[model samples]
Target: MPARPPARPVPPAPPPSPRDRLLAEAMRLFGERGVDAVTTREICAAAGVNPGAIHYHFGDKDGLYREVLRLPVAELDRQLAGFDDPGLSLHESIRRFIQPFLFDDGSCNAQLFFREMQAPSPVFMETVAREVGPLFDRFARLLARHAGMEQPNAAIHQLAMGLQAMAHDYSMTRPMLDAFHPELLADDPLLEQTCHRLADWGCALVEFERQRHASR
Candidate 1:
């Protein structure tokens, strides 16, 4: 038998940099446990980097957590940014806002965001101003139009917040919802039906409020 040719040397895989490693591990840990429960030492250990790397890269542990929390909100903002067509109806607007959270496909870690909402920090407010507020403002305007209200009124503002709260409940209560309402998790058709139902539910409330104001 002929001798085999010399074996080729395989290229070594490039290791993730300290910053990237810290970010990945931070998100994983934060998702598993809320931000308050995680420590910088654990994050560095999980990422296989020096403890000081957190400060060097992100200024401190809080900064790192802020960055972690910021990730999904930024994604959500990008997802909703394109929903600016003037022709969108109230139900369509509500559906679009709710779509990103429900059928996320792991693009944005909805659990991480929900955790932040459960235990809010300064980062939560910062994220709101930076990424979330504008999206809500857009929804508020659309909601006002559908509700037959003037811009920036107390009614419209309250209604917009209520609409968002409804969407959040749908996203955060999935485990319980799945147990109680199997059809919602079974297929896209049922899921969409649920979404339409939710949107119509919101529109009905808005219409009622609008009519109430008109009657006064």
Candidate 2:
């Protein structure tokens, strides 16, 4: 073989700009502690940016908080919308709805939403209405159809909330669940089993409610 010349070195990647850094750190801190509890200084420090970076990039702390709140919901909405196919069965719909939050490990949106639920800010309800409410309504409609209900009644709302809680509780309680029962965290199989149980319970509960309402 002929001798080859040495290759040139590749340049290093550029650091994240202050705006992007600020947004990322703000989202993380706000997820860990509510916006009311986290300060601009802390976010700036975490991002390795100056204190003025928040004002420069986001206008103010509240502005950043609002962005942080909206970012996760927007992503989750995007993910759930992919499952809106009319042909999806009830169980499949439920799986797609919960899969992103429970199984997809790349995004911190689920943790952020859990934190928002724990200590909501002033814009919580508004954010939910704009970004998350439609998804919940879609799930409710699916549940109602699967359970053989025609109208939007109290039972539908309750079943929707039940399913939502079942899906959300896994993310919120995962740390505790892991600590107490590490076996559950051994691998993906356990998590899949847990999701199946949640789906089963949610489906059964909806049917039970349907029966109860029918007898009344």
**Against the correct fold, how does model 2 do in TM-score?**
0.77
Between which residue pairs do clashes occur in model 2?
none
lDDT of 1 by residue, 49-72 (tens): 998999999999878977887777
Query: Which segments of model 1 are wrong by more than 4 Å?
Result: 1-15, 103-108, 181-190
Question: Which of the numbered candidates is closest to the native, going by highest TM-score?
Answer: 1
* C-alpha lDDT score of every prediction, in listed order: 0.77, 0.75
Clashing residue pair totals per candidate (backbone < 3 A): 0, 0
* Candidate 1, RMSD to the unseen true structure: 5.3
User: For model 1, which pairs clash?
Assistant: none
Model 2 per-residue lDDT tens digits across residues 1-216: 988989989999998898888889877776666677888999999999988988987788877877777776777778888564779766777777776556535345555666667777677777778778888888787777777777657778877877777666676677788799888768754378777767777767877877877798
The most accurate candidate by lDDT is 1
lDDT of 2 at 85: 73
